[model samples]
Target: MSRNTTTHDEFSDRTILVTGSSRGIGAATAKELAERGGDVVVNYRTSEDRAEAVVDSITDAGGEAIAVQADVRDPDAVDELVATAESAFGTIDVLVNNANISFSRTPFLEHPWDEFRDKLVGEIRAAYNCTQAVTPGMLEHEYGRIVYVSSEATRTVRPGFSSHVVAKSALNGLARSVATELASEGVVANVISPGPVRTEASADVLEQFEDQLIAETPMGDLAEPRDVARTVALFASDDASFVTGTRTPVNGGLLVE
Candidate 1:
C-alpha cells in the first residue's frame, strides 16, 4: 500500500470529477485515477491552496488535473462545476461523491433536530446534485461510473452517529436506484463504505481508539486512505462493468456480515 502504484489504464481517455477531493480519501482517489491515466477534476468547497496542491502534484506526476471550487450542496454550483470540468476535459465519465460534513459526536438525545435535518439534507442534496448533473453526459456516451463514498457506520451502528448513518443509508439506497435505472444505459453505480480510515480529520479519533479499533478489527489494523481509493479505482474502471448496485466495505474486516 504505497500511494499511486495502480497500473490500470482503463481511464486513459476518461475524465473524473471528485468532490471534496482536496484531501483525505477524495484526494487519494483523485490521484489514483490520474495515475491510472484519467484526467481529474478536484472539487473543493474551500481549501483552495490544498486543492491547488493536489492539482500540482498530479501535474508534476505527468497526469492531467484541475481544481474547481463549488459547494456540492447547491444545485447551480454543482452544475457549474460539472460544466467547468467538461470544458477542460471535454466530458466527465465518472462522478465520485465524496464531499460530506463531519459528524458531531453528541448523544442522540442531545442532538438538535435542526442539526440532524441539516446534515441529512446537505449530504443527500450534494449527491443528488452531482448525480443529476453527470448523468446526461454519461447517457450520451453510454458509459459512466457513479461512486458514492458512504460509511460502515450505517451497518455497524455507533453512539453519536445516528444522523450520519441515516444519511449514508439513504445515499446507499440512492446509488442502488441509480444503478437500476441507468444500468441499461451502460452506466453503473456503487457505494464504498469504509471503516475507520486514517486521515487528517480522523487522526485524533484514531489516537484515542487505536487499541479498541484494532482489537475489534479482525485484520488488526486501520485502513489508509489509499486502501479505500484502490477500491474506488476498481469500480470506476471498465473492469467493473458488470458490478453495479453493490456496496463494498473497506473497514478492515470489522463488523462483517
Candidate 2:
C-alpha cells in the first residue's frame, strides 16, 4: 500500500479499476485505493499525461498502479480495459464508475432534444458497458464490488443542470438493480453521492455556490475530493460486506436523507 495506509490491508491482493482517474475525485479515489493495498488501474479516455502522473505518484509511494486509456462509453474499449487490467494484476475485484459526467448547463426549456438525449445516453451507456465487461470476471471469481460516483444534484435541484441530474438519477436505479441481482452471486453495488466537492478545477463553481452550500451544510465546508475517495474505499472494502444497493451521501450533511 501507499504511505497513507492506516495499518489496514483493506484491499490487499485486490485489483481495482477507477475510471476517469486522471484528475479530481477519480484521481483521489485511485490513490486512496492504492494506499489501501489495491493494485489499481487508473483508466482515462484522454489526458495521458495526467493519468501517468497519477500512476507515477502511486508507484513512487510504493503502491501498485498503471494508467490505461479507454472510453468507458464504448463496450469494445471497456472490454479491452478489463482484459488489460486483468492481464496486469490477474483480475479486477472492484470497479469504480466515475466517468461520463460531462455536465451541460443549458436551462431545461432551452436544452435541445439531441443534447438531452446524448447526456442521458452517454452516462448510462458507459455504466452499462463497464458493468457488462467486468461482471463476468467478477462472477467467475465469486467476488466483486462496484461503486458508482453519483451526484447530490439528483435530489437537490439545481438550475441549468436538468440533464445532469436526470442522468445521475438513472445511476440510482442501476445500482439498485445490479446490487439486487448480483448480491447472491457474491457481487455488490452501491453509490457515493457527493455534494459540491472542492477540487483544483472547481474555483469558478466554488465562487458561485460555496457560500450557499456551506451555509446549508452542517459540516460548514465543501467536501474535498479525498473525503469522497475515502467513502469509495469504504464501499470497496471488506468493511462494507453487508452494504449493498444503498446510496451513501458525502455531502457534509446538507441533504439529511
For model 1, residues 151-250, the per-residue Cα lDDT tens digits are 9989878788889989999999999999999999999999999999999988987888988999999988889988999999999988899999999999
TM-score, cand. 2 vs. native = 0.96
The superposed Cα distance between candidate 2 and the true structure at residue 160, in angstroms, equals 0.4
User: Clashing pairs in model 1?
Assistant: none
Q: Which ten residues in a row have the lowest lDDT in candidate 2?
A: 1-10
- Among all windows of 10 consecutive residues in model 1, the one with the lowest summed lDDT is 1-10
- Candidate 1: residue 174 Cα off by (Å): 0.7
TM-score leader = 1
- Model 2 residue pairs with clashes: none
- Per-model CA lDDT versus the true structure: 0.92, 0.91
Candidate 2 residue-pair clash tally: 0
TM-score of each: 0.97, 0.96
Give the number of colliding residue pairs in candidate 1: 0
RMSD of each: 1.4, 2.6
